[model samples]
Target: MIDYTSPIQTTFELQRRSLEQSQQALEQSVDIGQQISESLLAGLDSQEQFQRRLVELNRDTVASALDAIESLPGADVAVDDLRENIDDGYERLLDGHEEAFDNISAELEDGTDSYDDLTAELLETVEEQLDLLVEAHEELEAQSVEAVDELAGQVEELQDQAEDVQAQIEQVSEDAARAVEA
Candidate 1:
């Protein structure tokens, strides 16, 4: 008996793992953002630290963003590959089921006495394979949806952070202008 479920199961597992990794990456990004904000606020007491921290923050932020952008293509490729694997699995499952049914029908037409036993066994196998495929598909779909939602939330958060940073920079500029005028 050919085990058709293993490949699908492995694909789902790989996708789930990838999702987990992405979530971890997002968390790390958030952590870095928080650290940058904290560093900016903390150095306000000292001119040297304030200037140094700002430089460091800019460098870190740019580096982090570049790292993220670079990783995106690989992530996209993984997702595309996963989708292709899923499509292939579905096609193979359907083809196998169809072939099994055709074979059983042909045997029945020939008035084979063993057709009943063969059909029953084939039906059971098909049902099991179908169930596995459906379950895997549902799991993969749910995971993908959840990952997308989380990523959207992360993007929104990063946007908010950017806005906050911009506001801070503007305030600093205004303060410097006032001091210069005085």
Candidate 2:
């Protein structure tokens, strides 16, 4: 009739809530980390665009300046060489940006997967341990109930024995009265 395992049940409920909160926090943190990564990549992308535009502007300015001095010997070859070098620099910058993005993205993905896996395992372990505690508590309660039943049976048997002795005493008293009358 009494819920002896109420405390354990309450503890389990509280632990479950705490675990759920932990899981939620982990998820939120992962999302925030991902957002940060995306922001960083976007910033880098914007910078790359800006740098490419700057290189283009420089190339055009140099070309226009050379055109103004086209009467000079080798002016055209000098303009072409300057443009090629600027183009090469831009290409290298682009490659570096791509490499950095790939590295960061890969690392973030791997880290996320590891964190998720660790969280799942931790939660599962806690649940399993909690279940075992409940199971053990239930067994203990069952044993207590059995012991109480056994004790009650013993007390009832003692009472029955006492009543039998009382009946014998009365019979003996009557026999003595009859003997005294004779």
lDDT of 2 by residue, 1-182 (tens): 33444555566567656766776676676667667766765776687678667766776776677567765787777767766776687678767866876686677667766766776676677567766865776576666667666776777788889898998888889998999999
Ten residues in sequence with the least summed lDDT for candidate 1: 40-49
Put down candidate 1 lDDT per residue, 36-121, tens digits, no spaces: 54454344335444544665566566556555655785665655565566556655755665566556555544443354356556
Question: Which candidate has the highest lDDT of all?
Answer: 2
- Alpha-carbon RMSD of each model: 42.4, 7.6
Best by TM-score: 2
Give the distance in Å from residue 82's predicted Cα in candidate 1 to where it truly belongs.
Answer: 84
User: Pairs clashing in candidate 1?
Assistant: none
Q: Model 2 — TM-score against the truth?
A: 0.45
* lDDT (C-alpha) at residue 56 in model 1: 56
Clash count per candidate: 0, 0
